[model samples]
Target: MVRAAARLPLFFLAASLVAGFLLRAPRSQRVDSEAARQSPRARTAVAATGELVKSLRIGGTIGTLRSAAIRAPELRGSHVVGWAVLTLVRLADAGSSVEAGDVVAEFELKRLEDHIADLQSYVTQAQASLRKRRSEIRILQGAWQHEALRARAESAKAVLGLPTAEVLSAIEAEILRMAAAVARARGKRQAEVERLRALVIAADLGYFDVWIRKELLHIERHSRDYKRLRMKTPIGGMVIRETIFNRSGEYAQVKAGDRINSGALFMRIADTSQMVVRAMVNQVDARTIRVGNRAVVQLDAYPGLRFSGHVAEMAALASPRRGTRSAGRMFIRQIPVRILIEDKDKRVLPGLSASVDVIVSMGQRGVLIPREALQHETGQQAGTFVRVAEGGEYRKRHIAVQGLSDTEALIRSGLAPGEQVLLKGLPRDQRR
Candidate 1:
């Protein structure tokens, strides 16, 4: 259930609603007419004894003090082009407790997986092609080596014939000289063959490298896209899906069938152990609320339950509260305050509406009575007057009420302990 927290400070404007010193209102008693028939008024009660404290209630939401927001896996720093849209296939339900490294949301990964499979297959094919190219180069190198050896042998034979040319006839000597020149030229062709051999080696390596680069790039893209498909909570806590405003001006939770933009806030994981209430105090009352002030936390869902806490942090700056615009001007400036919950309870959850009452003064023992016994004059809510049974006749006794509570009121003066007073109906304004 979502609700606004702007009306909390207004709930407790006068007396402190904090439950530090509990009120013990004395029970109303029935008076006998035999004692007094002159002033037959209403029921009477003796003043009881209890302690009273002054506090102020500030409205806020109960949340984990050390919470971390879990967003959609962001690939902004990565080299992905254009808006990345993903289909949500699996997601953890809201309010479920999760452990560290748990899967919070899973997107449609079949497409990514299929692309990765293709890239892997290409890598395999590239490996095979590299091996095949190496084998072919080996065969070609062997042929070149045989040609060079044959050329060297022919050159050696030609030189042998030249050494005996001087003893041969003129025609035989000329033919032998021409044969030696041709053999020497043929031997010199080995250098060109070696150049061709180097070219072939380079060509084969270059062909394999072209495919290798393509294979690595595809593999990199596949790995990066695959990791972005699944998202996880970094710490152990509860999961809360964030509500995103779409281009159509509609706010909705990121769910299945919803396409999320790149770098959009998706989900949040909160630390449940250290819970606190975040409240906004008016600029005037903000000064009274300081860090380390003891307070009482109350939840709307669980009535009659009070949790103890203390102010943990105070905002260094004040700003206008959101959604408080009216007549083209700012409404009120509020200071954000954080109160740390001292005790743990099952009902305490993130985003739950709660209120914190700051204790301003320590409790002191005083004469206490039920708030019903005090009667207020018309148009006045304070300065309750009581009908005290004194001098054998019931009369009005104006008493000074120092502190008040839901069911009790502390008399600072005028009303004494063990004194009898007439009890009225009930107060018009309720404390809580």
Candidate 2:
């Protein structure tokens, strides 16, 4: 009787556990079905009919349309001059506003000034020496004239004695003839000496004159260099520091106390009134882009800023894409394009990252949607599809694309205005 009662309780417990599991299974499945119907896994967008504008977006760097580059002054004075490297003493701070004819940079003029002073001293000394040489030549010429006059007088006296000898004895006549011949010869010798001395004096004067002129030229050249050492900006604009190789041979922004090579550009002054964006477009799109095409420029740094612009120029030839490799035999070619920004703003600075939206096609009425919403059907069903939202589920439908821009796609068929479409596609169960 005790065993029978224990068995009865065990059987009753087993029956209750089986009934509880059977009751809960249907409820759990019902809750899951309700949740799936209420919540959406993919975000949806409404299809719209509007003017579809197609634009080609290209990235570029901002630059001034008119700018002047400041370079280290070249040593133009003399070939064998001092200061092989130009040491910057004072430089205009970057981003500082400057006016025309403003001093943008100043070098250590100590060496240059000293060099100019030494050259001037040399020039002064040379001028004095030249003057002394002229005086000496004049004095030598006077001495030559006096000696010639004395020789002529001696010859005349000897000739007169020869006539006296003719009236005397034969021996006296012979002695007079010899004295006349000797005097004539002495005069001729003196004339020859004077002629040679005159030529020598003329040569010496010419040499001294050339030397003086050379020294004067050196002085002038050094003076010009001295003026160049004080660098000045030719136009009014903001100063921009340039990256250059420092004394340690590392690339860095140009600053005071840096030594730069002659003629190396160290800074630039940009004309903020007019700006430009230098961009590169693929060769495939190059044919469609033309000069004077309207464009809108947006800066990456300042997302809210937009500037109006137009295509100013395009490169004639295409260049090979740098830092990229070709998939096979064909390499990518990029065509350079320059866009001139028409809008003037203080924030439009050089070297800013910007994007240009070159309007290729004007607005045309068509059904448009976000390009990401369009999906491609694979396998046996091969076509473009977009998932439409209906009753908490997605329906895949074929759509015909008329045109695709950088951001939006123009739909030609299989989609209507005001229909909600999923931006992302769901699984097979969620998408009918």
Candidate 3:
């Protein structure tokens, strides 16, 4: 049932075509006696005198060729309690004029501020700990030095006692000599241990200083992050909100209270000093439009106004028309083209819906012929011809065609102005 409901529009379109099919008048009949026909080509029209201009109609929107984009604040690497995102507190209204240094967006800084405070406190504690450790290392150094000096002093005293060995018994002399050697050995060992202990203390102090420095750096980075909560525009321009995909998979403009990922495009400051009409030409008519072709643009918002421009650039590639998934699936392609407006108007604004007519050829009082009167035969000798009504019969005349559009042809030769041309019903000799 859902499938059938979805196809109802198609069924309605088919029904409308069937209902309107009878209203359209068929073209000329065939030649010969039996080809006497249905709907004879009796719809005759006289060639009129006028300027005939041929052009291609393309639909597009008014926009600038280039624009400056305002991006969201980069807060990606600052990890605290996980992957942190800034809360949007303020957003500039779309279309509002903003200047340099104007705050476009502001994020909630309370969290970052609190984190900064925590880092500062940690740094203070780390510095204090580093200072206390350094003091303790100094005290240990003094104690170790004194112990080493006292051991050396005892060894000297033992050496002095050894001088008495010559005047004393042999056993006493040997004991004095051994005591002095033992004191010297103990002093050397104590000095070696003190050197090792000093090395440990130096390493500990270096680590302590490094830890404190890291804490201070972290604090500085957090303070910078807190300052980054406010985003500013580099130049003054009218604000244009940038569209981003929401969690629901739909694109929407970034606004206040919206949590956006780091580095996401948040807004645009359009360079409106120069405006261009960006149009898409269908592939069938794309080749006719080229760079340097003249175009006239009409804004849908202001129906009475028109602006002239020239094709500044055209896309090197074609793509399925954007904004429609069905177009991609159906393989319908359109070439993008830009026309720079020559005359600037204050009322003209970006994003306005506009219709652009790219002039193919401008006819200057050329003879115009109705499209139905011309026959486009397909062959080597295939020429564009028109049936002329002369003296109770129609005669086929091959003519030099200047340009032909969808509805009319601008004739360079052959047909004269005010000449009556046979249409729809044709003479049997002229009909196929």
Candidate 4:
């Protein structure tokens, strides 16, 4: 039994040693297999000969080709009461069509009425004064005529050598002078009457001479205001905006009694018949943007839809935003580029945000490779690697990269088409 027990201990120790060896051997084999699978193999550098060179892209937005703003008219009188919008018969809605000489709006005539009344009063006073003047002139004329007639009779007697012939001659001369005076008085009276009549007639017709002159002067002063406030579409197009006062028994924020300031923004209008994409480029990129440069516009609201356009113009000057500084002292230059679209729909609205892509250049056919292939060494050398068939190794090859994009680079030279290049990390054994 003692010998069997000692033998059993040795056998058990041998079995444990074998099992440990078997477990360790499989683990070592597994490690080797995994390493082999992870290692990179030799790959033939193939050339990608396809359309690689494409147009350079720039950004822009969709906008209206034409736009307008409506403003208030310049009216006089601080105490001038509220305004009454009198739409002329021919006036149309913002998007509606209109003909020339259409009345857009008219002011209330209360002030004008008061002016007419005051003028009438002045006319009445003028007529009364004129009548008094005429009566005085007539009385003077009558007295002068009587004296002259008596003197004329005396003169006739004198001429015939009657009694007091010298006195009579003097009296007859006085009568002739008195007759001339009466004629002058009559002429003055007639002029006064005519002037009064003119004043009265003008007042009766609601047309005061001075007031008419003033009205003309007012028209001259507000001509520009009228033109602006009329809010006519400079070109024939669809009205994209309109301001309609609601008359649903709700009092307006500004009413007939409320005062409005001159130059207020009363309304706005835009022409939507044609649309454009307006893009603002940075000062650095603004120089590259020119009229007639082709572009692509994308709306965030409408994804996957791209509209094509061209740069119509660039602004002459740069205008910065208020109270804000630009980055890198690079003021936001004014690059007013208009991108025209052939199709205009309701989807395009004024002030809708949009993105624009301007084509700077196009590379139709060129050699391109993934950007990851490029590697920069400590010596500041940029190059890529190509795998060699021999012993699964890679050769460090230098290539000239012309243009680089987000995902690829344009290979100018030092590489041929259908050439195989290494991707990802190098083989673990080869990595230093």
TM-score of 2: 0.77
In terms of lDDT, the poorest run of 10 residues in model 4 is 82-91
* Colliding residue pairs in candidate 2: none
Clashes per candidate, residues 3 or more apart or on different chains: 3, 0, 4, 22
Per-candidate TM-scores read 0.66, 0.77, 0.66, 0.48
Ordered list by lDDT, greatest first: 2, 3, 1, 4
Q: What is the lDDT of residue 43 in candidate 4?
A: 34
The reply for model 3, stretches above 4 Å from the true place, is: 1-54, 159-170, 242-253, 281-290, 320-334, 360-402, 405-432
Clashes in model 3: which pairs?
40-425, 41-424, 41-425, 42-425
56-172 in candidate 1: lDDT tens per residue? 788899888876766556544234433366667888998899999888888777866776687788888888888898898789788988988988898899888897888999999
lDDT of 3 by residue, 1-432 (tens): 999999999999999898777554242222343465553556688988777778887888889876777666666355645425556779889989888788888888777778778878888888889888888888878988898889889988987787688898988888888999998898789878988997898799888888878878777766776677887887777789888776567788877777777767788877666799988888889988889998888899899698989999999989887766773465878888999988878777898999887888876778888777888676887888888888867778888888776557788989998988877766555566
Q: What TM-score should be assigned to candidate 1?
A: 0.66
Per-residue lDDT of 318-390 in model 2, one digit per residue for the tens? Answer: 8888667657524788999999999888888888999999989876689999888999978999999998877
RMSD of each: 17.1, 8.5, 14.5, 13.9
lDDT of 3 at 300: 93
Instruction: State the weakest 10-residue window (summed lDDT) of model 2.
Output: 76-85
Judge candidate 1 at residue 110 and give its lDDT. 80
> Against the hidden true structure, what lDDT does model 2 obtain?
0.87
Distance (Å) between predicted and true CA of 50, model 3?
8.2
